[model samples]
Target chain A: MNRAPGLKTYAVIYLLFLYGPILILPLFAFNDASIVAFPLAGFTTKWFAEMWADPNLWKALKNSLIIALSTATLSTVLGIFAARSSVRYKWPGKPVVMGFIMLPLVLPEMIVAMSLLIVLLGIGINLSIFTVIMGHVLMCTPFAVAILTSAFQSLDRSLEEAALDLGESAASTFRLIILPLVMPGILSSFLITFTISIDEFIVANFLGSGQPILSVYIFGQFRFPAKVPSMLALGTILVGVSVVLLAIAEYFRRRGIARTGGKDTGGFL
Target chain B: MTFSPDRPTMIEFRDVHKYYGDYHALRGINGTIRAGEFFSLLGPSGCGKTTLLRTIAGFEGIDNGAVLIDGKDMAKVPANARPTNMVFQSYAIFPHMSVAENVGFGLRRDPRSRTEKAAAVEEALEMVGLKGYGARAAHALSGGQRQRVALARALILKPKVLLLDEPLSALDKKMREHMQVELIKLQRQVGITFILVTHDQEEALVMSDRIAVMFEGQIAQLADPETLYRRPNGRKVADFIGTMNFIPCQILSETGGRIEVEAKGLGRVMLDEDQVPPARGEGEPVVGLRPETLTMLYPGQEPQERAVAGRIDEVIYFGDMTYYDVFIGGTDVEVRLSMRNVPGRPVLDVGTEVQLAWSPSALVLFR
Candidate 1:
């Protein structure tokens, strides 16, 4: 095939436009100057040290970790039930129910946060980290269900029937066969939901009342010009963590497909 | 034809019927499968063969009939509680488990100790010619090996009846033929009543002691393989089982224990009472003859009782046997006949005038 002139250059520019800003975070984080701008600055680790010593930053990190962990576990558990029933059984109103479950994936996060704040306040529930966790779960569950549903759908129906024919009860068959086959999918779901909850800004900012959260705290620190360099360092670390976590998730997803002897029908890379 | 008269019944379907929404899957199936017999439910697809097999395994529930296994009503029994096991069409080997784990899966509820169960798994594996394969991953095995594993897994439990649903359909031709003999031997050694569901007529004829041919969710005929091939109850069963050349005929007279019919190009002949099956009102009266029953005689060879003058219209060579479609006796009726390719005999060519020899006893009148 003859190449179109400048196609390669166009591709390179397109990729740069998508990710060039993310590449800038680490560069500015390591720069020695306080101002985030051009002109070469000498290297320094002082901003990283400053970030490590902040007590308020540590508090916010602890709160974010708790919320992300809780949201990941709860949403993945709910996803298993929803995906299993949706894939295996037929019932009245199934499409409508599944549609409602997946609606939060496309619903704007700002609107979701505003309505949830109104409902929680109107119900007389005090805002806390727990409320922030609830909001994150609602937002993350649709993603978990989408991933796990494909995993469950790839399984052969005869495998379950063969187990039952071999005298295994329904529950034992699920524990022995169904759970192990879809374990990698569960891991992928957990990692994705955890990543979503950790970086989530709108819901965490609106629902946490006055509690310290990493996203909200980072937003507040932007008011101080001198604190900007340390915040950039923290952002650089977050980017590195996200990349590693997603890589691990993709690895397990590929391994699961290999274990089942199924074709790699592309997955999240 | 080899079935004895004294064996007890293992499974019985009493007017079973099944439905899937508006589609009637199994209309009303009634039959009995004898103990220690290798039985088959044979039909084309959508003929309710698999549905009937599942009803015995308790995987499917009939709408208005009873399925009895070993004289016990299985209406309330779940699939896991039934005394029957199935080798699925896909074999359904657990991709995540080793061969040993899959074979011993059903032993979880057994009262035996661990080592004793392990020995039993080994014995089952040996029975299926997969003795040293228990440690290998199931996903790595070939199609034939997976079928063997599925067999060993189902037979290890020693169920009263074993159900197989087209277990050899996934293999190539050579492998499928090899497994058919193995399945027959395994069925005999275990002495468990085996029921197989297959859409391939040849597979059913080769592996089953008796076969129940189904059509449109009902049992069209149930008899031994030899009887099914030799004396099908109607034209539909006769056509489905093998190649039968149907020639138009007219009933001339009926006598005591005899039926006189004038067949096309073959002249008049008298048929025995057994040769005339009960009328099914299918179509016009016709006489059916198997291709192998008719033989082409060479020059100076004597006819076996009766002979019809025929001209060879088409010749199909099958290595050892040659099939010729002959237009018999100044008529447009073409019937196929097979002749053995002996060392001294020559293959007949098209447009050759040959005398086709057939007997009156081989003719089955379907009216």
Candidate 2:
């Protein structure tokens, strides 16, 4: 409830700084001129059309979609279990387990990506979309787990206990009671992991070969002037998709907040 | 080994002991809760009342001995395997489930068809007076409605016993009063044993058929509410269960069914402690009385016949009764009287000389 002055300033500054560049992507994508530089050129949609016409672009988009979907599914299922156990039980090594789950979030992304690449190479796992999926799953699972752990932690464990006392078996009780209760947190975790997997650059860059992802494709397009605006169009679309996904993520996040009796503060006190 | 079908023994804690690591939670406790009895484990917080209730609910494992439900040992029985259910202190209503879904949650084992289960859910919801609120999510309902949903969910399974952990502690005063009466009626209709855990003595007194007063993880006294309140086992039991005014006294003589005590400040008083054990020739014996049993100060009363001479030092005026802290012969003693706000309470201000008196029978003698 406290509307402390300093945090409000920090929050205002953070929102503008984080969102300013992404907002500019859509504006430039619509710019008519091929060259993306200073000077107002009239608006056009040719780059978008140009991007659609490219076969390579389509293949990359398809590959990214497959990878992101698989990654999200893999991460979400694992995340749900990991989060539930981490929050619900008091195992002897719980602290160590939590630290391991959160390591990816705190560790540098490049280090994790590089380590995964080297580990995959050592195990003779080839560089491909499969490898890319594994990499994204690895990078995204931690985020998924972290997001979900918070969600599960906020829910009262007594609901599950109540269900069990009413004679629902452990497995069915989870399906019938705990899952529904933490669904908002579960969904936000899914979308966030999906977004992270789709938007990831390093793992896809290091692991993808013979199958380039959207991030890799976008990076390749940065060199050619003819491909610049088209890439800008592609980037614009990705940004919009990401924003929409993030917005949906935010929706579920807000829903989870509201569902758990979260504070209705404009900002944290 | 099993109870009869007519008057069943629904739940029994047979020498049950629970330990959380090294700390003993429920000591070798043995008790049986009959079907259709409203029983309360009354105690201060940390007295392991909740732990004992949880052990019956299958949430906590008994470290030793067995908790029996329908004469079956529950030591190895998981919570989900037991037919007993609980309404947690927080109500524990599934926030995601609508009122109907929550009620139907336990009906998964219904021998009836899905449609019949659905109908049963409706019946349970209606039983709790939440008939029309089936579709609304649990979080949307008010606190009282959620509590009913919790009750309905537990009841739908037709559990032999229902464990309620301080179920009314979270409610507002008016809501709690209304619910207490409703709960009694609901229990009568269901005819299942209700094992309730609460620290609120008044709540235990009002709702329970029998109250077990616990102290430091042990049941100090277990009896009907009337006996528990009136003839508490000792000074600790007396002090814990209700308000008491205790003062140092000397045992003058012991006889059948009665003993005379010479209280230091108060005059000779008579007490009945069931044959009055041989007098303790010790540091100090004490006489106690419940505040409600003592009468108020009166100017016209005989000064010499009264228990003590004292000045009323403080007056704590509760709406129903006014309590006076009197300085009787240098020892401060408290007395309470039901107020008749005619000329208002016998306006005894601080530092005022007041002569307090009590009948000899009111002197509750204790060593």
Top model by DockQ, which number?
1
My TM-score estimates for the predictions, one after another, are 0.97, 0.88
Candidate 2 lDDT score at position A144 = 87
Q: DockQ of candidates 1 onward, in order?
A: 0.83, 0.59
lDDT of 2 by residue, B169-188 (tens): 88999999999999988988
- TM-score of predicted chain B, candidate 2: 0.88
Model 2 residue A90 CA deviation (Å) reads: 1.3
In TM-score terms, candidate 2 sits at: 0.88
Per-candidate Cα lDDT values, in order, are 0.93, 0.79
Q: Write the per-residue lDDT of candidate 2 for residues A235-265, one digit (tens) a residue.
A: 7877777667677667765765576554533
Per-residue CA lDDT of model 1 for B242-319, tens digit only, reads 999999999999998698999999999999999999855988999999999998787989996999998989999999
User: Considering only chain A, what is the TM-score of each predicted structure?
Assistant: 0.95, 0.85
Best model number under TM-score: 1
Interface RMSD of 2: 2.0
Model 1 docking category = high
